[model samples]
Target chain A: MADLLRLDRDPAAALRETAQRAAVRDWTCATLGLGESATVLVTELSCAEPGCPPREVVIAVFAPHAPRRQCRIHCALAELDESRVRAAWLAPTPCGGSHD
Target chain B: MTDTNDKVPVTVLTGFLGAGKTTLLNRILTENHGQRIAVIENEFGEIGVDQELVINAEEEIFEMNNGCICCTVRGDLIRILGSLMKRRDRFDRIVVETTGMANPGPVAQTFFVDDDMRERFALDGIVTLVDARHFGQQVDANEEAREQVAFADVIVLNKTDLVTATELEAVERRVRAMNALARIVRSDPAARAAVPVDSVLGIGGFDLSRALEYKPTFLEPEYPFEWAGRFDLAAGRHELVLGEGPDPDMGLALFPAPPVEAEDPARVAAERAFKWFAEDVEANAPGTLLRPAESLAILDLQGTGSKRFPVQVDAPGRYWLVTQHLPEEFALALHDPQGRPVRPGLERAFAAGHTHDDEVGSISLETEEPLDPRRFSDWLSRELQAQGASIYRMKGFLNFKGVDQRVVIQGVHMLTDNTTLGPWGEKPRRTQLVFIGRNLDTQALIDGFDACLAD
Candidate 1:
């Protein structure tokens, strides 16, 4: 994804990334079998720490009574596919999420 | 990353109970700063007396969950900031008042750990108010008091008139020893946390250059060895006599000295000594011969009498003797083979192992070598996972192999953010990291960082 600040200067790019984020949120809600009460937040975080990808999409699923479930895809929001999201959420992960 | 100029600046206020947090908050609101400022107050108890004290601001309190159990960010803060951004033109800056018992780590980390918050807000600085009259007792009795001082960028010593001049000086010295980087400002006792408004506000404590622009002594790390002496010796055996004192064992290292005219000779010798200290110790009983080698030697001084350890000098040259503890502590002395006392031509004492609080202190590690990126990331992740609960704050500038730009990392507990500031250009490439926390193992941190060095 483009730099957050740079996207501010380029409105078209910002709009595109925002739309992609919304699409990811919808996909996460569907794949997780979340109900309307569940809050699904999809955010793209950029990290410069060594061994970390340049950008990753973090999907946090907060259900009504269950614990929060989070999964990350080491790619930009635009590049994320439905199958990848489905597999990531279906795979058994640790209590919080797979930080790797 | 967001442009700092476009984001709203936030100044966090944290201090112990009875410290002038509310006084400072009221002072900021009444002062003619020519800006509309919003205040966010976090009260500890159910009574909520602070909200009534604040003026000319809307009081909105929201309680929510911070998703992950280990994460410390207040969910209410995230919701409040999100709501405030909708009416961005209503305010120019923000000031958050944390309770006396609150740790400022979570409050500061919220600006960086959250994606939306990171883009919308900039943590300008953390101004800690310290009550001069009750500082000694509060710091001694409470851990939160010490943590607030350790994490402050600007410390306002309030209520100066309540204590004598000598008491104020002692408290200032103690605070300085605990945190060498904070800019200390004395407030008017009569005015109640009143100082120049510019001193607390507009100070870019989180900015890299501004954060590192404190005293030069802050860049100096606390050395492991306390004393180092330069001695010119002949190619013969020398006796190191030690009288019983504190511990049963003493760590020592001898290295060939660089030329006297060499630039930064002390630092040069220290670098070698640190590497040797990190290696496995060669344990020697009393009366055992210690030859000049590339490892640290541990002399066992178990008995209650003077112990003699022979040190062999293979070549006639100047050598440096570094001891883990001060020579005065153990009555350590050296004698040449001719039975003549050899006085050191040069002696230096390192500022080591002196802290305001025993459990809460800071560890600084510095190296000129560029670090391996992958190894550094792995080591940091593992460390934060294991010791995040105790680590209050961490900040550093690193030189990573294959990366030309300098990497700036700032972290609070488990959440960390690393960003490229700029290219190295003409400046020397170096990695400096400072960790402020409780029960920190200095050797373990040093060894872990050393392992990340690029081969």
Candidate 2:
């Protein structure tokens, strides 16, 4: 996802060890609303950089409220993305869509 | 202007996001019978799918600079269109696609104001599209929706296939309230082009014909207004109205009327008193209350014809808000340096204690248990007379103590008449009056509501 942001200079990078099936479950359980006790699987991850095992993992994000509920997280994220884009494209308008 | 042979009429295609504006534009571009068109897209905010849309000539996108279009439209629109006209052969008719939230004034003005530009580009009329699913939500609460309709030469109620007959009628009812002129067409873009380019080319002024005329009467004196198209108001409760109608005086009169500068102690003091207004509304309602769009129009006491002053309405849970002025009176006030309530009359009206030694506009607020419609209207009439406010329009739903049903009262000062909504039921939750006047106490009217409630 950071690749999508395409920010400057430092260029985001990260690392997390345990690179195994068990490690993947723990990380995802915490992230995917599975709670610490739930068993995990090799659902998602990658090792694009090579040499290093695929440390990055994937888990379902839950709603801030109604915890553990699979609320439309897409709405929240979509909202931010929607507004961010509208704001970025704005310049001088010939005026708003209003009239006398 | 250039002869019809060389210079083509520039049409502005505008409306809310997902209102099929681009879809319609794409239709015109890809399926046109025979006409070269160049398209320009100006988004309200940053993100834009202009690249995704099509046209014959190369496209250009202008981001609203840091300032507002009202303040900077002159410079920005000119640069884009001025350049477009330079590559005359590349395109024939120029179509402008505005961001769903962007106003269409500056865009329209590009033709009206500049001589050289005017000579080359003709004002082909404003074509605003409405989403059938969310037209009601957009028009009832969204200032942009009303603006778009008010100034439209042609309106495309796109997505007619998605809405119900009853809901579509409601959209037309509301649209009639805001605008008396406009040509409306129910369109399924994929099936039929909303309006053939020939019918649209060189069209000017509002076209008063469509899905609106046959519907029931309105709450205003205009009776059967020029209803053009029908749409779905409840289609998408989640969607908000995007584009406003076209503004002629460059955007001086849209809602959130242009800001009144602090030129002297008087204006400065007045502005200071109202400063808390923007922040307070935003704080109180959170997402439902504050609107950055209205921020520009509200701050002024003297009105600019550019924008509508911001007004708030509590409908169900969502605020059915607008800045179109209702009737009222006015009295000038002496203010304090801090812009607090210093004048006794100003203090009493707002019921606000703080005073400033500055000039503030004042109006009388009189409420009685019986709530005489005639008498109350008289007080209101007197208020408008005293303040000398150009009351463009006024409407409200009042539930009186004795009345069994709710009362719908509306007036367009230009028409000099108002109609009372009958067959009222349920006492009004609260008696509210909104004055969308310039340099006047919009807050004062809201405050009067709390004090003037049924006793």
Candidate 3:
């Protein structure tokens, strides 16, 4: 929680996080073999579920006519690495059907 | 890394078919608002006619994966907004024009659900246009129409000249019933969808605090509680008895009712109670005593078929009670110390429900081959003339034979517009087109594009 609040108090921290997220998104796309048309969303959400980390990064992949795929990393966006992303993608969890 | 105050303001424009959304959009672009505005439109048909109607701005159209009706976020909006924030200096604000049949839920939800969007862009408001004469039928016939009215921060009743004053009053009544919170402004009939720029732009309709400041009774339908009751109480301990219900615990808030002279007293108290219920919860086990304070308290109703909690009232005055669910659902009742029922003097139910349009959908067409300009134009004209009624919105980039620049095209029904958007340069030239509407023939559209390919 303090780390997330630092993003609001420090401009440098926010910029660093934004850059890191963009890099992670690019790496995820490359590792997952997703095209430009596919929409890749990387979000850092606070986990309320017991036994889960305080904060985690959720990466969701959406493409036309394909089932939505996502993976959760038990770490903050800054702590995420390419190896972790690849590992998550390899054992990706199927997301719920439709946002409706 | 801009501060929250410096984030760009975005306004979402939505309405039913033939509601003068494009006319209002043109007025916004032509007006001297002193702000450079970038417009993103999701037209129903494949030709970009709305883009041509817009002046002094380049059209950027992105398609979302709407094949699954349950997809929550508008993928196209997320992609376009992400790119727009990168070149934030180019535009002062952004206005998104959704297709007429759009639900506007996914469009508005995109701002809050996406982390990057939430940080960089603030949803200024959702402005909906209503065709004064046809709104009544539209609202009754289409769920999308009703949802647009329900979710608007500002409702612009356009085409007033076409309807009589009596008929207009009836329509306004219907709009008000659908959304009591929205500020309804009648458009200038002589000017055609003309509205005061300030009424729509720069309004913090989405800002909850600002909304509450503007209207003390500002309550969104998505709140947890649905009903609020005002009761006249004496200075003593009252008992709140609850029967078996769904949840293990129930959230409750008790606050001083607003003065009788206050405007919309019921809503004012409801809004205040809503704030209290959102605060940190203080849980009380069954048979425990709870003091009525300006905060939230939870009653643990588990393990007992019926639980009783004492509510202490400090002073004899009017107090409001807000429960997480309707009291009837839990068979909840309040009693005076003597065991007599303490009935509420007033009760108000907040509107709560969500609906989506399942009939409307989008089709995407893509080809690597460049098109013959003359042949493509003739085919498009013929298609719009024949099937424009069914085709709601169409937009995409076209790669023309012997033309270096990329041609942008968009259309709504019979209206179509196109412009050459500089040379493709080193990028690959591929024609991508998308049509959003009802009852579209996928094979026919694909074959039509194939026929327009250069030999």
Candidate 4:
């Protein structure tokens, strides 16, 4: 019963990654009130810093009439939740303003 | 006597890496073409190595710093080309070999936009060499590859031997899809001596007559800025106080009018003083009351609660401010700090429903009615001086009242080249223009051009 399903070779990981990205995109669009024309890119980025963790989910938003906005969640794509995304999206910019 | 001071034609060579550009260039150099060619070699590497690859011939070779010729190295090309022009023994023709991943748009635009570049050098054509083996992958992966083909007058389909007949046909189809007008020259990779030197060089692909008809793709860019406003006011000191935007660092470029020169000596003296203020503002120098050129005095607003700054206007004219966000987001106010409102709460200069692409966008206007030459010139001069930095490239064929020939106006930033193309020749007398830039107002530009039409 232990090795019956072979979870290690699960192809659903790729499918889950895609679905998670779509969910993240949908959530971002809904939260930001972005139009269909707006472009959203979600990726896993690695940072080599003392305080910064190795792997993180990075969300990039490009909407017309506004500057490009990028936010980083300190988690993997599969581990991303709506509350976590909301927190990251609402995080203050480097200049002390809300993320555009 | 031959005019030795005549403008030398510049042919820009562009393509992806390992695309037989060096082969084509070497062929041109070694060939007894009787033309003294000055080659400007631009490579994208830490150390410039492509210059060493060039075959030693009786030609002038200038190596540009390692960077994309389109962006960082563009200024280098202009400066080097300018220096080359000042020489006593000038080359008959100039050739610029841009890095593989280079957009030829800015390079081709240098000739059209720079005053000295236009007077001293003319853009002959952009000849792109396509590596037939990797054409599909390169075109798919690289925007530069696609642009090189799109902007080319000549496309050398090099390394034909590496690909099969079917593959070659597919590559040709893809190349044609990108640019139907470019003359595609097929060259074998094995045959180095058989390079199409004759077909590539001296081809006037950058014909201004045909360039006026804007390419649709050239206009497609998502502009960072969206809305813009143009304000006309009497000569006085004014203040533009910014409110807020989605981004804390909201940027707005204000273009104040250049001082108008009047015949009166008093007016001339006043104009000089006003111009000094404009210069100081543009330079971000402290103590200048008005700074039209700066972004509403962002540098001055450091650690300040209020975002208001004073600007001096010497002459009565129009001052335009193009903002990165919508007018509401950044309620940038233009008013006299001391005097009353000119329009009485009409602080919003001209709130346009301006929607452009996310990057670089374009706006074009075509009118059948002939425009008054003086009015058109004045409008263009003011427009360029104000918003030239954001406006990347502008070219148009103008139909004027008295002029027998059609006037072709080409500009890059503030630099413009206006030349008369001989006669309408039974064709439609139309004024057509295309402006490619970041956050341009299409309706505003169209309205401005329409105003130039004679009553």
Judging by DockQ against the true structure, name the best candidate: 1
Question: Each candidate's DockQ score against the native complex?
Answer: 0.06, 0.01, 0.04, 0.01
Question: Top model by lDDT, which number?
Answer: 1
TM-score of each: 0.61, 0.36, 0.46, 0.42
lDDT of 3 by residue, A15-98 (tens): 788798888888889887987666677866544456767767767776654555676677788998888788777753523112
lDDT of 4 at B440: 63
lDDT of 2 at B133: 86
Over B1-455, each residue of candidate 2 has an lDDT whose tens digit, in order, gives 12234556778877887887766766676654676767766643222333332323212222222222321122344445545554677666777777787656555544533234544666566788888788767765776665666556667777877766545654554444344345566775356346565545556332111212322221112211111111111211231211222211111111221234333422222233343333322112112322323332222333332222222322212111122121011111112223332222111111122232222222223233435344354455445444423332343445455555444443322112222334544533434332322245555454534443444
Native-to-model Cα distance after best TM-score fit, residue B417 in candidate 1, in Å = 1.4
Tens digit of per-residue lDDT, candidate 3, span B205-234: 754334435544333344557678889998
lDDT of 1 by residue, B1-455 (tens): 44686989999988999888887877777777897887777753332333322322222221112333225455456556655665678888988888888777667766765555676788989999999999999888988898898888889999998987657766776787666667788998777788888878888877656778754556666677777888899889899999986689888888788766567666677767877776675678999998776569999998789999888888999888888877877888999988687888988766564444547667788899988877788788777767776777787888888889887776766666666788999989999887877787778888999999998
Per-residue lDDT of B263 in model 4: 53
The lDDT of model 3 is: 0.70
User: B164-275 in candidate 4: lDDT tens per residue?
Assistant: 7657765765675445345677886578425656677766555555432323232222333444444676666877665544345544556653456335432222222222
For model 4, state the Cα shift of residue B280 in Å.
66
**Model 4 chain B — which ten-residue stretch has the worst lDDT?**
B57-66
Candidate 3's DockQ is 0.04
What CAPRI-style quality would you assign to candidate 3? incorrect
lDDT of 3 at A20: 89
